[model samples]
Target: MRLEELMNEHYDEFNENDLHILKYVLNHKATSSQMSINQLAEACHTSRSSVHRLTKKLNFAGYSEFKVFLKWESQPAEQESRHTEILTNDIEATMKNLADTNFELLSNKLVSARRIFIYGSGTAQLTCATEAQRLFAVVNTFVTIIHDQVEFETMFPSMSDEDIIIIVSLSGDTPALLPQARKLNAKGIEFISITNLKNNKLAQLSPAAIYVTSSPTATEKGAGLASFIPFHIAIETLIRHFAEYLNV
Candidate 1:
């Protein structure tokens, strides 16, 4: 797994100070990778112990191991022929994972659920959710789209086993959504996670999960523009299976 993956997996554990240190590291990967723990702490204006704790949260033994991972990410890979080629690879990987996955259980759940709702963790994810809603609506299977955190919290208390939720998230480690995931798990509510291809806390908390491959693009600030095409493909493919299962 990449350093980014490790950080994302433990994202919820990070506090404000940890995030401040993380921001510095992400913005200056090459420099930070070469710096000693003391240098990094000085640069980030935090305590050495704070930096050490951040490394521990990322599952690193210490700063040394964490620096090694950072160095690896900074090393340039052999360039692909084109940006489109990267997306092609992502699609191919996503299809392979989807092919091996059996969607029968999820399709059955959708068919049997009394009410279905879909929520997206971010704007890009919401587009995918909208597509899912439109596709399912064509078959007369109306899906309620949960708009935001407030809406989800309001609806959650009334949700039962007969209801199902489809959560679309890129990292699958969105801090705000994790609490809802835990609530769903504790309440025995059936929810499915559609997340980027990685081991994530949300996927672990859900009853079922669908993984999609995403190609990393250049970062504007700290955010990477990972392609969402795979998400759309996954959603469409899932709905096709659900339609078949519904005999529609």
Candidate 2:
């Protein structure tokens, strides 16, 4: 249970003395964990019995357990901050890589394609739709963005040489995209991929790859910190170049 939940659940049960102790705990929870029962009592301007009573009121076995809980509750924010720092550094590196990749050449390819089909599975599909709308709004071209893998592949037979497909995947190893890339390759369809800057199969199969490098340093945070930032920025960057190429 979270410390906040405990306080809310038993807020009414606390007496005036307990309230005084709680105020000290809330204000100094980080430092409170290191302090002894006597130290806490002194800080709260209360007696040891009052400190013991407050811990009991909060349903803790004793002061030690309460302090342990406080310490544990404070750790996630620090870990999250470290995870955020790693992502920031990765973003800088990804931007540098983007700068070195001749986006003008990419723009020429986009401008020449007769039809653009953007396919993104899972979370990245949202960016595909939004970016598709943005591209169409600016370039005023023939474009389609399908979030579903089956729906996108259904149009494969009808796909022509003039058509170009763009794949957006966070992991760059999507099961759904594997077969789709094979289909494109067999039909000699040159495609673009937006994915993590890893030695992944999707990037290897595609004619053009736009990589967004967000290192998975925060294994504890899972996919929460993984980003599609480069996908968004790359799409916008290409659209700007497409505008310049068309003079629109």
Candidate topping lDDT: 1
Per-residue CA lDDT of model 2 for 18-71, tens digit only, reads 877877777787888889999999998889998888889889999889889889
Clashing pairs in 2: none
lDDT of 2 at 56: 90
User: Each candidate's lDDT (Cα)?
Assistant: 0.86, 0.74
Model 1 ranges with Cα > 4 A deviation:
1-78, 219-223
RMSD of each: 6.9, 19.2
**How would you encode candidate 1's per-residue C-alpha lDDT over 165-219 as one tens digit per residue?**
9999998889999999988888878998888876577876777778788867764
For residue 82, give model 1's deviation from the true position in Å.
2.4
Query: Which 10-residue window of candidate 1 scores lowest in summed lDDT?
Result: 1-10
Clashing pairs in 1: none
